[model samples]
Target chain A: MRDDVPLAATAAGGTRGDEECCTLATGPLDAADAQRLSEAFKALSDPTRLRLLAHVADQGCASVCACDLTELMGISQPTVSHHMKKLVEAGLVTREQRGRWAHYSVVPAAFAELRAFLDLR
Target chain B: MRDDVPLAATAAGGTRGDEECCTLATGPLDAADAQRLSEAFKALSDPTRLRLLAHVADQGCASVCACDLTELMGISQPTVSHHMKKLVEAGLVTREQRGRWAHYSVVPAAFAELRAFLDLR
Candidate 1:
């Protein structure tokens, strides 16, 4: 994915029409939005997930497969997949299927929005 | 508090020596650190808490009292106090007592750290 592209767009595989880009303080977030955002944060709250995020981010812009994550996290494939699912669903990570493997990377805009949400002033 | 002050520093109320400011990507966060950070996010996960956070953040740099939150959230005084306690304990908000009132403000450094934690790259 192009680094210059918006996070939601990158997550959608360069398809910008599918998602909207907004900051947390742009306006009031509804309960559902807050709940959804909270779930993403909750998923990241775990040490395993935090490590998983660190691994993926450290890999440069490249995405790694679930197999690699399983080995790194010392967890089963299913468990890694579950965490990946949560990360992907939360827009924290993006998954792309290439041949027999799926690659994951961090979504910048999602991170930006979350960062803005935590903006104290 | 001065707007230019760092978050942890501001939370410490001009006592910068008491806190250290750092980002999530700077290094590995241990389990206890993750646990503590998660608790803060968990405190922010609730709708009422989110609203409270929003209210406090929206008030510029000024801190709000528990009495104001109880009315805004439509929650009881004890419940608001409890939520305030959680927020303060988590380090997401700072508490100051003036006479019989307890004023709370968002801690910027805490928000910055959390925002960094959410950073995908």
Candidate 2:
């Protein structure tokens, strides 16, 4: 819901040479970072969205069309669009137009940031 | 919300030697796993809860009392208790009672499962 907090910026921020590790165990998270992560996690908090994302991620280097997702997930096109919009806005997924349909792919950096944040060591 | 999908069972399921890797990139998640993960993610979807979890995780080997979290997060006792309840129910955090106050700690395996799920490899 907090689209104001961009996952791309947080992922980029984590890579700066002097930056401290972004894991939750390292230290208390500031409000801004917490906002960003909570937004990303919220985008992932739905079962339908998680399955949709997994389908896309499972494709590896290949991208999947929105129409294919609707068919695959057995959901309406509008529902797919709604979930995809949330994922793209949260920066976990990227959308690109190919002809009339939109194609999506997982943004590796975003997932990496999330994974890094969960690191308890 | 959907607390029926226990995270401890999922974390334990991941450790079975014959089990497939749990990363989202590897395969499509089944309905049950999706339900479980969504519940965990939903619990983490709030900013206050994320900061609260981080504070507990930052303690490493130690646990923090609920009273201490109320003071550190600058929130009222009820708010802290509410967030803590969500975290504990999701299996992302553990609760223990010592005398009058509840103590909390991060569940490392729960976080490891989340981190693993994000793997885009």
| TM-score winner | 2
- Scoring only the A-chain of each prediction against the true A-chain gives TM-scores of 0.69, 0.78
lDDT of 1 by residue, A1-121 (tens): 1234322321212222212211236445667767766776776766677777776665544556666777666789888877788789878777877576566766666776777777543
> What is candidate 2's lDDT per residue for A50-69, written digit by digit as tens?
99999887766556777778
Error of 2 at B104 (Å): 0.5
Clashes of 1: 1
Q: Candidate 2 — which pairs collide?
A: none
What is the per-residue lDDT of model 2 for residues B46-104, given as tens digits with 9 covering 90 to 100? 99999999888776646677777877789998999999999999998878876777877
Q: Which candidate achieves the best lDDT against the true structure?
A: 2
lDDT score, residue A35, model 1? Answer: 75
Task: At residue A100, give the lDDT of candidate 1.
Answer: 66
User: Which ranges of candidate 2 are over 4 A from the true structure?
Assistant: A1-25, B1-25
Please list the residue runs of candidate 1 whose C-alpha ends up more than 4 Å from where it truly belongs after superposition.
Answer: A1-32, A98-100, B1-33, B98-100
